[model samples]
Target: MPNKHLFFLLLLTAMALALPSYYFDSNSIRFIFFIGVVAIWRYLWALQHFIRALFFLKVKFKRLRQQEQAIGEIADPKHIFILVTSFRIETDTSILVYKSAIAEAIRLKQPVTIIASIVEPSDERLIKQIFYNSAPPLRVSLKLVRIKGSGKRDGLAVGFRAISNSQVDLESAVVAVVDGDSVLTENCIKNCYRFFSINPKLGALTTNESCELTQSSRTLAIYRRWYNLRFAQRHEFMCSVALSNRVLTLTGRMSMFRGDIVGSSEFIDRIEFDYIDHWRLGRFRFLTGDDKSSWFQILKDGWQMLYVPDVKVLTIEQPPHNNFIKGATLLMVRWFGNMLRANTCARQLPRVVMGSYVWWLLRDQLISIWTSLFGLVLAIMGGLYYGETIFYAFAFWILLTRYLLSALLSTLHGHFSLSWPILLYFSQIYGSMVKIYVLSHMYRQVWTRQKTTLKDSGNRLEHFIRTFGSNIALLGSASIFLTVVAFIAGVLTTYDIQAFISYYFS
Candidate 1:
């Protein structure tokens, strides 16, 4: 089906649905049509991604495997540089991660350098012990660099500099940035290295991720499931975007990059000192999300980013706190904060520069912050005016759609659980709220895993203003969105909003 044909078909279908609502006099019918249309589009979004990702997973991987050189048969494999940042990571997880990386390097039969960036002397010793115990061949070496506990960005900069300065061939070599807690599975590199080998314009690529939770607590268990579901969804989203030769983020967990781009001075500078010029906040320095900087640089320079759905990176899970609600809220604050900050910058790119679909994806992130909560607010308002039956009807509809959505996600990971539906709703509603809160306070940064924050001076008046402004903005936006939702639910009229706006602005 061509895009032109598909677009016309969809437009006609929408027109047909709207005719009934135009004829019907009841708000009940209109609200039903609204909900139905929203659900249809949501499923359509999922359906397209499922098809795109499936094509890549089934078709692309098979074709690449058939055409590309075998793992050990390449004529001249590039020098592999694995940069692992292990700040405050558990010792056991560190050993497992480094040991697996060393094994992969040794297996490659190519010259490899592993740079371990850490602030702890013990971790340095531990990594060294693993290196020596493996007794890697002469082709393998270790470069230990210590940082001042600044952040992952600084650690990565130091490691990247080491690689950039080496005698290796910058054009053909490869760099892998791995978190301390993420372990490489067997053949992870073998599966991904071929993509960069085949595609000359490929600047970087990221692999699928899976979390390994060792704790037995029930709260941690639920969180583990939530993390797994997120990764599953991430796999599909990354694959779909990669079809356009671009990914939103290269992923900080573990992503491979072309050696030349990774070593470039401009690339390093972008990641190390990335900042956004805000109209209100002046210059907002990035406290995290180095991966976004890297992705944006590649996108701007006309390079490709591939998502290797077959290669999986295992991350050792660590809960931010014992209480799930508090931990989840804080984690969302950081995640959405990073997203909104980077997204705001990306949306400013011209359509010609970013492409239409890619730019739409960034713009949709802001629109979704409001639309996600619309149905919920509508349901509550409908119940207040109509009856309990209206709320029950909406509740049933929500549960069905969420469950079906979660079940469809199994196509990515081939696993489904009863908890996914519940978590999906939790994520949608809670995540939207977090995005709203973080939108107004994106300048304030914090790291979830490490207790890190943006360096700032202590000033009571300035801090109070910042806090007050965020609250006012959040409340104002919520009030406006709720008002709109209420109007759609027929609880409020156009005159009501017009009068309020006139009074407020007047």
Candidate 2:
């Protein structure tokens, strides 16, 4: 996702694309050509996003001005609902988050409802204290919805349902969904809410996010880079996707939606109970990634989602673990699990409804898990059988290409990091492995911060069978991949494979 990240991507694409006049047989050329073609196609895909993102920046600025003018002519949504979801959050963080929400509502000077969906009674008391201490207007009232520490999804549903039962007019109201740790910047709510009123079809919109880490023990600094790099990539991708009036996911950190959409019973149900019936996995329920569920439902119902690049949200973060690898792995497992679970979305909905570009984006999620590792496998095999020259060529290509690409990437995010190249490779390679594992064991889900997890409910024997089956699938897939690499690398011939098969059977 980082700019330098594309170095290996494009490098492999060139090797894959320019198959050239290899001395090997047609099969080898065909194999290389096929990989090249996929790489080239994705290379263009990323390139298109880059070009569109640049144009989108200008369009976003112009559109904001136009929207303000439009609002002056017509009335914008006067009623606002702020849904804040928090669980086991620190007291100081609770104060910052609740105060920020109150400030946003007070600025609007409209009849606003602030709902705190929390598990702790102390949080409720803290919020109430903050609310009265600010001396907020009578129009800005507070509501507390207590949950039994179930999860974020349940907390959100309870909050939304409470809003739907209120006296406000759902048709003309706008609802802002914010995580408890996320603090809004000045005019953050005001900037996005006006867009929903002017654009009738705009279902929801999310603001850009920046993060701050509180508890540091040396390893925390790497997470700082990780979060920023991810946020930077998100800013670019969201802007690019928003050009088509679609975003891959509506971030849970801070997003605003048309009240009717968020208030509907169907929408609440999607958040509460989203599941899939995979051919191999059978039927499994989702444990996380409620945002993806929300996005899918909104898009399916023929609504538009947008990204406001200018406005930002400040997210308060803590290190997931003292060991960076353990923390990073846990986070990726959750993220990629959400992605692989959302893979079937393209087929479930009508192609014409979601548009071709959006449909392909969902499909790309499925393909990327494999393609992310394809070149590495080829490079390793080529080194062993073909020659060391092929391996070193790949290594040298990475060094030169990443060093150059990283320089250009800094212009995109307005900052430069000497460590961008190393971070990018770890994200791509490790992220791919995590995706592959999650795809096989789609039933596993975890909330890293809360230490909550959900698995298929079964007895000891059934659980063993499930674990064994997943391991077999994972190892089996790896074996097939290596075999294919052997043939492609010219280490195994057609006769070699046939003779082996015959000998084994005999």
Candidate 3:
């Protein structure tokens, strides 16, 4: 069905169910009212984030247009450094990224230095060939830095050190870090540079990301495509966060920084040896999440970070495993692990330093995992006891609210498809579960890209207890809370808890 038709159908269906009380008794009305309250709370929470996102987006584009109109007034950087890092990268992806970088360089019409950080000599040769074959208009200068196949952090450190040693004018140069699989948009540099020109305090800026799905299976493709769309939605939240002079992560896929900042020894040190002092796991080394380390360093230095929503990078996303569930699980484990590790110390920063809103976001990370599950579990239990009315109402509420949100987001982000509402539910429920597991096993870190595993120190039994204990406690607590709520609801509706329980369970 067409999006327009489907949307209207959803709207009409929602309207049909809007007056459920008219069709049911007073008890049913109360139950529906309770569900409505919860739905409203969730909607308002999402609306707050969305509204801030829309506002920042408006501001970003306005600034972009203004900068474009007065292009001659804005001083373009003297040198633009494109740092490309690769580790056992596919030849096709490496070629695409380098080609895009060269094209972008030509468009910028600046003397561009391309630094290729590679562990495999084969990749270095391939990249060198791409640059060497580039047209004269590109004006591409190539530097190949070889590193041990250690990790992304090490590769980035090597590149940063080389940039520091180069003769580029740091004050007027911009360094962009692009992942091996990421292709830069033509206007990425132009749009990002304007921010640096406008604000000298802007330390770094990350662009919006769109993904190219590489999964062969149709099911996996659908899942990956929707996942990418949701990822775009996340950028909206980041935009709002960036307005407070803090972005949760400066994505390594493609983020630009001032040359001086990237060249500094402090920045290099952070990228090279970023670690968290875990109470249980001792000083755990950061095996991944180079992006988080960079963001933290910038944040710690009081540098302003901004999100360029208009500027986007096309990232090639390959499923880690053939099975969608397995792939998503692996990806989430790595991602949430990275986030949880960084967040441990991030929450310790002074409120003035991190901003109160950011602090709240950090706190929300801990609560939201369980809260997301709470609603679904409530609906399920309500269905079991009270029949399908509660379940149907809950589903209707999710569909109507998420579809409306998807429509609004699609208008802004352009990838919101009919599948988005379904994906939203999956992300909320399954994604929350993944986050909960990762939160418990924060010490687990793995590089899904290169199949590298970093083990947390401890015996299997100790690790199992530490990891699963939190989950058990969380479930037990939620069960007790829900039981109490159910008892109260039973009394309010049926007026006899014992009879209500017997009617359902018996």
Candidate 4:
């Protein structure tokens, strides 16, 4: 079911029933107690957000239906500026992204401006050729803007500069921003235009990304499936399902921006302008989660964010080349780091404690960190005590539970996929490990003047296995010995408190 809270409810009830035995007999029972507490916290967190998402989803859907009926026509826009931002290594899927956008550009007779910024000082001419030659018709004029830079948001600066320099009338025209790896659905542009046409209050419109799937590319395919199931699926559902009434942030992957909103100083400051004083003592570089940063800025500018899930985009994902281990590491570091940074940002904002939202966000992050830390500890302990047997059991149980929850969530909401179960399991276990790595790296970067380029592959992993393995073994051995002692005491004594021992052994 879409109600993740339901699963938590049943799960929590069982834990509650067994809580007393755990406390009395097992030293390891502390972990179980921690789990129950976290589960309750998570249930409440999901319940509140899911309800809000549902409400907004209903309101937005109804509004869109009314708008579509009123208009009774499609493919209409006076002027549109399609903004595509790029950086670092290129992907083959840019061809598809351009193809999709070009279709929209032709339909609306809007000239498309493709901002192709090369991070490594590569030729913009090659990027220009890719889009220009790929265009279905020669009539549509494509402007290419390339910049030499690194970091996630660096390309955006170049893209923004190009848009401003175009000197287009900001009030009337619409600007569409789509990532190079994302392909827009046939009606995505039309839907965006239609929604904006009907509602004057909407400042930005979002289209959900449908990750491309294929059999040949297992790594990429698995990565794509996992992303859709975990990140995009939940994120879109949050906004489209009406979990949160107000659109928090329009994703940078594929989103439409009104010209006025993009050009306005308020949006520029609030969304686009991430004033990272690199010169400041603690601040390193402007490493950012671009889409969220943009959304926060828009919210600050008093603009309504609309998520049109019907407007779909097929986005290509690049998984690590070194297989599962590399992929897990990358995912954990980026996702956890981003979440932590966002939390830090939220706390720093004025009047953060004044709103229910700030508290919700804070609680969610804290609980996530707590759960991850506890899980890691438990896994290690189990590994040491029961040897690999306990570790595998614990891992399997978590993986299965996470998979079922994610799969059920996916099926209930919409966008069903077979890979949901497998990907869900992998992401759940590996995701946590990766996050630990990222969090640790982030701390190092902040405090130790460590370069972002420092590779985490070798030394970090060795340390984790060496350290965590030892701790798990030691704790597990102690737990096992204690359980045996408790069992013997129960056999000899009439009223021995052996429930906890039995539970552990069983």
Candidate scoring better on TM-score of 1 and 4:
1
Write one digit per residue (lDDT tens) for candidate 2, span 196-227: 76777889988898999988787887998888
Q: What is the TM-score of each candidate against the true structure?
A: 0.90, 0.91, 0.87, 0.68
Tens digits of per-residue lDDT, candidate 1, 391-456, equal 655665666677677767887778876678779898999899888888888788888788899976
RMSD in angstroms, candidate 4? 9.6
Better of 2 and 4 by TM-score: 2
Query: Global lDDT of each model?
Result: 0.81, 0.81, 0.79, 0.57
lDDT of 1 at 160: 89
lDDT of 3 by residue, 126-231 (tens): 8777776876454668889999988888999999999999988888999999999999988788777767877778899888888887757747766676676677
Question: How many pairs of residues in model 2 come into backbone collision?
Answer: 1
- Candidate 4 residue lDDT tens string, 347-400: 455543224454456555654654544554555655554455445445444644
Instruction: Please rank every candidate by TM-score, starting with the best.
Output: 2, 1, 3, 4
**Which portions of model 2 show Cα errors greater than 4 Å?**
1-35
> Against the hidden true structure, what lDDT does model 3 obtain?
0.79
**Candidate 3 clashing pairs, residues 3+ apart or interchain:** none
